[model samples]
Target chain A: MTKKAICFTAGKLAELGKENIPDELLSGKGLVYSSPATLAYNSPGAEGYGVKRAGLAVPESVMLIVAPGCCGRNTSLISNMPGYKNRFFYLEMNENDLVTGKHLARIPEAVTEIVEFLKDKTPRVVMICITCVDALLGTDMERVTRKAEEALRQKGFDKTRVRPCYMYALTREGRRPPMVHVRQTLYSLLEPMQKDPRTVNIIGNFAPLAEGELQRYLTRAGVTHIRQIGTSESYEDFLKMASANFNIVTDPEVRAAAEDMNANLNIPYIELTRVHGIDRIAKQYSAFAAATGIEIDDTEEREEAWEAVDALKERYPDLTFNIGESSNCDPFELATSLVRYGFKVDEIYATLSPERFVYIKNLARLSPDTKVYCNMEPTMIYYDMSGSKADITIGKDAGYYCPDIPNIAWNTDIKPFGYQGVRDLMNSIASKLEEGRA
Target chain B: MRGLRKVLTPFAPDQSGAVSVLYSLGGLIVVIDAGGCTGNICGFDEPRWQGAKSAIFSAGLRDMDAILGRDELLVKKTIDAASRIDCKFIALVGTPVPATIATDYKALKRMMEKKTDLPILTIPANGMRLYDEGEAMAYRQLAEVLGEEGNENKEESETVIGQTPLTYGMDYKDVSLEQMKLLGNSKIIAASASGVSFAESMGLRYEAKAEPAMKYLTEDLKGKVLVCHDEVFGKTLRDNGVDLDIATFFTLHDSIAREGDRKISEEDDFTKMVLEGGYDTVVADEILRELIPDFKGKFIDAPCFAISGRH
Candidate 1:
């Protein structure tokens, strides 16, 4: 028997501890943070949620942004919000700081200052944000925060709490990126809250949750209290999310966070990733309703989606499908899905994720010789561009490389969430194919 | 098998590293192309181009001839050109292009002394590879190569780096002068365009961009006692105090070394501003400690890491 072993050190994993934190209350509650990569690389122009979803599921108002003058310059979209304006602060460092590492002491001080600023109108939580510098300097932000918290508590400040939040671009693993990490952090916070009857927390906002379809599905299904993180009307409104009796993880990245909530708070979760076809999406919704004991009538939405797909099929019977992007969504699975709808997936440019690898293995069991190309490798070489039958491609940045084929930009930096994702995808594809036919 | 096919097919074409004419900072436009130039380590396989009539007359030059500085035909032509160029003075650009041993240089200098009276200067022309250090090293080497000049009344002017083909920009030059004036009390030759070449060669010293190249160099010359105690101007400015030093051109290198400032070049400035700024925000604190063993102070731009690569 081969013995399995774990290689990670406890010291490394336990580096973020209670004592090292600035505010125990903030950690006790929950917080999330995110940072953009300065120089980023995406496979063949694939969209990335590494930075945007770094702190996806945190109760919004509790988060604080910490970065250098140059690094945090682009986060104005977040900071300019009426809710998040006070949460952002900058610490300007120059060339001398890089070599000498003198900036380590300021971590706790900045945390304490931000907490104090929020003292008068303090929420039940505060999340201290730290970016990539902490990684390089190896500054024990948790310890520094703890020391600062102790100092602050002694100074007669009470009822104010802060916690350490990290937004690292280096650790993103395909679909399991920082946005997933943020959701896990937030779910862990909502775990302790008393569960409400018949309510469910939506765990799909690790990236932006498409509102139109997801909202309509929840409403039609009679599912109440649907909470989206990025589309939150108010940051403080995130506190009311604990009332949900259950949760649905529409994106895989939210699994860790959902699991944390389930393990701690007894809020069981069901993973229902984005499905892009009407029948497949309806079946997934029916299965989810059966598991959760909820009645969901997706009949109207399904009919609309089917009509749209049929219209697209009528116009482009010879349209060859090419999905070009690096993603966990298996091209073989997509091909099978399209086959059910009477469409041929001629060629695909994609990379398999660890999560999707099992699907491909199963796909090999069904179709012995399916042609799949890695996103980085050019498909034009193997399948001659002149003779190739591909008329439409679905992915980001594929049009630039393949001008012969018309492309639809359905790829995004957000995790496509839920059965609604399937509907949205169908709508998107239909529109593109129709437009191309015209 | 698929990966092997991808690699071995040879028909698969990639344009990722295709060479293009890129115009960047500095006055010179460098055209860099791959798949060429391999005569670096071993001796050249092909002889020098012999198409010219003058080259045909002196085709039999040898290593021994170079070492002894006795290639009469080559020396005669060089001397004739030096005397003939319509200029008040002539400067020699000594680069790795035609590398000779130190002994060869001495022999060549001796031969040139015996043969011609024109002012022949030699300066290194190492292209930009190791950042600003190349410029600084070349400038210093050029000064030493020039040896002692009888006319010591050279005008006090700062030679900016970005002025000619060997160029960067005025910002580095300004920063160089700022540091020069701050550390060395003398007026800068050209405060805006203090090229490293003139400062290093002409016995005039200039400050580097916020990197510690000059400071390290100055400190290394402690035997001469030509440096003053090191203090950070940024620190002094923060505390509202003046920490001053007066260094002459002869003692500039020593001053830099004594100051112990690592951010004496533009590369340091760019790194600190862009790369380090990103690192300080994203990575965990313990990880940072492990990576940067020599850390002391607090985080400089924690908030800067939030946005990234903009400010």
Candidate 2:
């Protein structure tokens, strides 16, 4: 007997209610399949700005990953990249170290060795990345990092700061996941400085956000210095982020960090979610204008976004999509927005959460029969894409699954957001579809 | 500074090696980890995972699950997955989480066996050990659980053991389950350090030679050449008239070990060897060149996926 991939329609999911969501749809319920979509979530270091990359987001920083050899194996992919060269070091833990917790003792010496080894390229910060082994052992990393700092100080390198970042996959479902924790750890480095009204820091996203109306909107409202960690030139330049009046949080994962900033540095924050729907973008911008007392007339940008959508619609009037969670945009929101634009969505590959049920409910109203496949489900091993009628696929994982279909891996480190994101995505789809036809 | 690695990232661990062996063997391979270990194996370690689908999964053990030592839940999850997925057998590969908790693989295997009729192969690979050890363990477990007694009627074919992508890179040729079952009767070839270890452990009469390394045997060398890869690769090169010394991070069997042939575990060991060996030519993965940038030696490129993942 042939087994099939398990899938539920948006309507069926909406009817099931969030509390009654199937175990297969929600992650952490069963064994997780190593699908490409799940790789980003499963192995945080595999793709994008995971704990390893995010820890090094601070300018002039190097990381020392202290864990079992397996934890740091995938880091070679990141290490080989041009930007990450000479930045990553390792302190591999063994069985004896696991038992005695002696790796913690060796970290200070290891940190000193790494700093001495990288003499001329002396780092302003050293991030100590520990994995689940420490998470299980309940190792006091904060004290260990302080000890490392003191060791550096005693060695006449007092300027060097040491910090610990957790790569605890076991605590992924907990309140503070590794991603969320890393953001907090990075932002916590910012010391309180005199607030500048013109300066605003964009918190979240290790890579710079796409040049769009979001930055333009802030700049048009008399904002002079717009700082982002990705665009910061040096350690001193990164330190200037401490003077920002407020933070504009782009990702939800960074909200805890934003809260920390609010408490520690007295920097207020405004959260803007990355959405695909033009209406939602407009509403979010309007809300932003109202809260910050910054008038954002998004009429031109809104029309431009809709124009791009219409242009794509004209070229492929009955275009259908297969969306995956590996993209920048939420699969449910993107699916719902596409359906609202009179385009068909055949399938969505993503893990479901109760917080995302609102989008699923909205999607049910627009596209009831759209099948939702959990990318991490054990049954996804049998996922056969032959029956799908998707003309195009969005996201890297979707591209992997549907090789024949024209795909736009909109999962670049450079994020897409707001009105410009919608416009760029629409044009990208049209361009890719044209390329496919050619 | 015992495990401080400044030049190279850590190589693929035992769990990854174990998975690499059992990847295509018609089994539901489950890594007893909290997603990251499984992700590292599929995303980085296992080159075959790209564009290929396998039944490899993470047990998805949470903090409480590991803290409380929930073996029954893991067994239930495996049984549930096996019910839906078509597989000939089931394999449980261990990682740091299991190692930290001191997970009893024997107990877990016994628990799963009662619920499901499928044969269970348990590889207790702590993530601390290197890939070669894990591969040898997997090969040993496969032979113990699946190997059949000598058959009089069946035709004997030479089965290659431990020629996985982790060791052979692009030249990896898989040994199927049927071939693995005939280990007792068929002639065996130990393809790498792991193969040699497995062959010796099982007391199987086998030819110890790396067929892939035979390609490097023809390279013209001037002076003393230092070959750093799997031990058998170096041995194969030496047998075919290469005046070389073997320095392997993997295994160095007594049969393959010659004078000056060292078993290295750190970056400094390799650096010291290259500096002191006085070799005119060094043959290893290009990634190792980062360690000895000052060494003025002719380097011959030998891509070992386990060392550099260059395939």
Candidate 3:
């Protein structure tokens, strides 16, 4: 067996130099590609928030993260992030409890105690986020949650609910990523209600999808009650989501949960991938309209979104860019869209998925030397584009990697979609580009 | 029920503490687990992660790789990573899954040693215990590997060992310097022990982050007089009393085999030792007030990460 010398940790090709590279380096041969996270990977990306922050997207939902000491330690920093301080709770798993499964029994009483303590604004759902320790112990959280629900009912809080979200990092590389499982779990709580054909539910994301063009489009189509899981101000509002005509799976990772809801509740869903290209956005909107049999006249908003992008191009022609992997925008698709707009896309720091190959292959063909590096690769520590001609950068990860450069994080907690998303993104970059390093 | 932390998260486990000791030493540290362990360590617990270049990685352990007991794949991925980057050594920190399956890390370490000359250290951290335990084990393991301690030719300046965020909080670097500077007049280099009580000896400015990191790295154990924090700092402070040492530990058995200061077994014992022993000041974390109620001596606060989980 020949020991092939290929870079596992990410490094710039220019830094490695051409002469040191073997001729068979880029050859599609018998090799395995892996993405073990690096320092760059630590930057909060879209894989989903920390366990403490995940289920808290709902108005009155609190998360109880159960693991050994180390598993819950990092949550302190995340606890300080906005909207997360009061909602997160923890249950530490010590050696004896883990070995004997003693902690599982305490979980029921613990939930009841937390509910009673909250006294004023009782939590609608208590999300028990289990970590890898439980995965190893093979602890049945489903049974544990059921027991907690029954115990809570016994305590007179008959309306309260308990659900489990798995933070099984071990299965991150498996068929269903952990975040996908989390989305499925969060949305599964909405039980079937009487059908209301005029309503639509925006599935996925904890950050509210508020006041976007998508909402306006739905409103124009006689969609009276548009609901989002993350925007529910009360448990009652969240429960009302079951009456929607159809579910719009706005985030790609939420498709699994949407499918589950469709199968179980007979509430069908249409998937929408957030994209930056104006033409592509239009096509997606048309497809969504066709799927729902609702006529959405979004021509004014679409033209306005394009006008914003065109204004930026006119002011700054042949601008070079570096796109980050973080945020709602798909890196490959976004990069390809930027390239198609006659913008000089310098490089992209993104992880490659099999579904994104079309964009990657097209990107390679259009800009042959465009570098594609995975932020999770350990060698990303050495990513230095000091000599590059790119004037501005996009995305938080990109901003960090290419420091001292004019960049835009372009990151908002709220889900960005459709024509309004284009306006928001382009507007953000345009304003930040003036400041250069904001 | 005492240190339960029902609402607050556990401060950190021993594995993360062990990783903190070696990460700043400029090596490619890989936590041999799924991604979350690495995330918690680098992203949260390890404060030096921001604005620093450390080659830490997750093994990206998947379901089958773990289920099948694939040590070879770990070895190969590690080797591939090492070949691509420049690292002095490799520390494979274990998580619960590997420990449950009883992954033969020593065998894997031996294979790695055979493959290349990189000094391999395996911290069999099962993610069950707290940070101080991990720091203690990692400190000992790394000491054994690189314990070429001979000041025969080198400068015998006053030194402080295990000076990192594991022992202190975000202000570890500043606090460590302050502790070392207090010992500047004395003709000794203070090599700090692993646990939070060692920080207490500096005066309880911080809460004990966790249980002590192995009682002490004693004088008999290493042929150097490892005196208590009080005996050295206490003498200089009669009028302008500077507490040279305030020796207290989480567990009683952790007391070092030094002569000068007696071991403080409980809160009352701590009070008696201070009042009768002619100690003018008590320096400890403010969080310790819950434990040590009758603190009559002048209080100088030191913060500890272990007990400050509510903060």
Task: Write the residue-wise lDDT of candidate 1 on A1-438 in tens digits.
Answer: 111111111122123332332121121111000000001222000124334324423433444444332233334444444544455544443334545555555655654555565657554445555544444456576676577567567765554455566554323333444455556655544426666664666766544465655566666667667765654454456655666777777667677877777677777888776656566677788888798776777677667767766776787665566665433344546665665577665555444344444444443444323445442221111223453356776664344335578776665646554444555666777677667679
Listed in order, each prediction's TM-score against the native is 0.51, 0.98, 0.81
**Best-fitting candidate, scored by TM-score:** 2
Off by over 4 Å in 3: A1-48, B149-155, B170-302, B305-311
Candidate 1, residue A102: lDDT: 54
Instruction: Kindly report the TM-score of the first chain in candidate 1.
Output: 0.70
C-alpha displacement of B105 in model 1, angstroms?
A: 32
DockQ of 2: 0.81
Worst 10 residues of 2 chain A by lDDT: A37-46
For candidate 2, lDDT tens digit of each residue in A78-156?
8877789999999999899989998899999999999999999899999999999999999999999999999999999
Models ranked on DockQ: 2, 3, 1
Task: Give one digit per residue, the lDDT tens place, for model 3 in B129-225.
Answer: 6565576567556645644433232333433444456544653432222223333232222223453333344332322222232232222222111
Q: Report the C-alpha displacement of residue B109, candidate 1, in angstroms.
A: 35
Worst 10 residues of 1 chain B by lDDT: B12-21
DockQ of model 3 vs. true complex:
0.30
Using DockQ as the measure, the top candidate is: 2
Q: iRMS of every model, one decimal?
A: 28.5, 1.1, 5.6
Q: What is the C-alpha RMSD of each candidate to the true structure, in Å?
A: 21.3, 1.3, 8.2
Runs off by more than 4 Å, candidate 1: A1-48, A56-87, A92-102, A114-126, A129-140, A148-160, A173-177, A206-208, A211-222, A326-332, A353-371, A376-389, A412-420, A433-438, B1-311
The sequence of per-residue lDDT tens digits that candidate 2 reaches over residues B1-311 is: 78999989899899989999999988999999888898889988899998567899999889999999999999989999999999999999999999999999999999999999999999999899999899999999888898887653233788888899999887998889987887766788888988999989988788888899988765566698999999988888888888889999998999779898999998989999999989988989999998899889898889888778787
